[model samples]
Target: MTKIPAISLRRLSKSFGDLDVLGVMDLDVGRGEFVSILGPSGCGKSTLLSILSGIEEATTGEITIHGAPLNQSGQPFAWMPQNDALLPWRTVVDNVGLGYQVAGRLSKRAARDQARLLLPAFGLEEFSRALPYQLSGGMRQRVALARTIAQGRDMLLLDEPFGALDAITRTELQLWLEQIWGVDRPTVILITHDVREAVLLSDRIYVFSDRPAQIVAEFEVPLDRPRTIEMLAGAQATQLELDLLRALHVGSGDTP
Candidate 1:
């Protein structure tokens, strides 16, 4: 069966002032599938994301989510940025619920009640009363994911949510994120500079070229579901990673 695409981009293109930032990009994301966009810096990965999230406009293209066009203001989708963006003064529980509070969508009591419900899942029930400053980096990212998950949106646009973590923490969180997303099955488009990280998590990866970014290659990740670091040593995963590194070389300029 042809799975319904959660997001569809047809002939997408974008430009900044006089410079072309993205051009004639085409993409499709099936419902509940996790896809990653990998590329070098200045390839408009962020710009493309801005358009997908409706944070920025598309110069020429179409974006459809669940078969409907996305209007400005980026509704029906939640975006988690590279930074957790938590307020230090707020309690962990309070920070998670801040989304509803700022939107005036729920009363403080209701919001906290809802946010409190997620504490156990992220393993932060004990730290609910603590402030952001009191939590470790991994814990802070948990709070960020908890906040995004709390929104109950069907699509998640994750822009290097784990990039700032140390190697050990990053690997641990990769497993954690895979568990959550696999269980919930929300359509996800992750943007990351770490090619290895992208290889470990995505169903498929879209490789982009520089400045006027466009898709140069797309590779299907053949590693089976519930992926683990142990697979990191497996032949299939290694081959896919090598192929992706090669894909980045398709464009002009320095690439590794």
Candidate 2:
């Protein structure tokens, strides 16, 4: 028997009044797979994530998780938006545990204890008691990521999680994320505009057309697991980057 996909969308579309954000689209994410959605700005990449996370309702279509209908009550995904969005007043640990506290799934103390255990993995152990204001941008993103991971959800919807950082920091976090994903293997759908970022991290990539977005191309990255920075500089990876960049231009209707 075939394995059920972790998430599936058929004819999924979204609109706001007179504006259409996403056209009819069909997509699937396999269990523990890392998929990236590449598109131009305002091309409905974030809108797709909003719909999947239940923050926005779809205009039309079917959505399924593990072959069953979506269950909004279950809160099946952990989402990390472009900005770190950490609460400045809260300590790193508190912010990390905020999800559990808000969901009433654990007592404040229990939540902090659980979050504390995850801080070391994200390199935030020493800063557990530090406020968000005290940390650098990269560190703040790590805390936000730790919070997302603390939820223990099976799916991660990352909407440009590393987009705001400087190039060096972003690359560091990318490698860090690869290591984490290798260990935990949660199903992931990342939204990014960076061709190299997509090429570096995704198991598969789907390029979307400009506004009122629809997938225009898809490519599978056959690179080996435990992907490293060195691998990204190889001939195969360079070619893949160029291919994805070409697709992005095509999707945007630019001469490539």
The models' CA-based lDDT, in order, is 0.85, 0.91
User: How much does candidate 1 score in TM-score?
Assistant: 0.94
Residue-wise C-alpha lDDT for candidate 1, range 1-256, written one tens digit per residue: 4765788899989987899999798899988789999988767888877877778999998888777787743586788877899988899999898766654378878989988988898889999999998899999999999888877777888988888999999998999998888887888999887888998899989998877988888988989889888987899988988888888876535654
- lDDT (Cα) of model 2: 0.91
Could you list the CA RMSD of all candidates, in the order they appear? 1.9, 1.3
Error of 2 at 255 (Å): 2.1
lDDT of 2 by residue, 179-209 (tens): 9999979999999998888988999999999
Error of 1 at 112 (Å): 0.6
Among all candidates shown, the one with the greatest TM-score: 2
Question: How many clashing pairs per prediction, in order?
Answer: 0, 0
The true-versus-predicted C-alpha distance at residue 217 of model 2, in Å, is 0.6
Best by lDDT: 2
Question: What is candidate 1's CA lDDT for residue 214?
Answer: 80
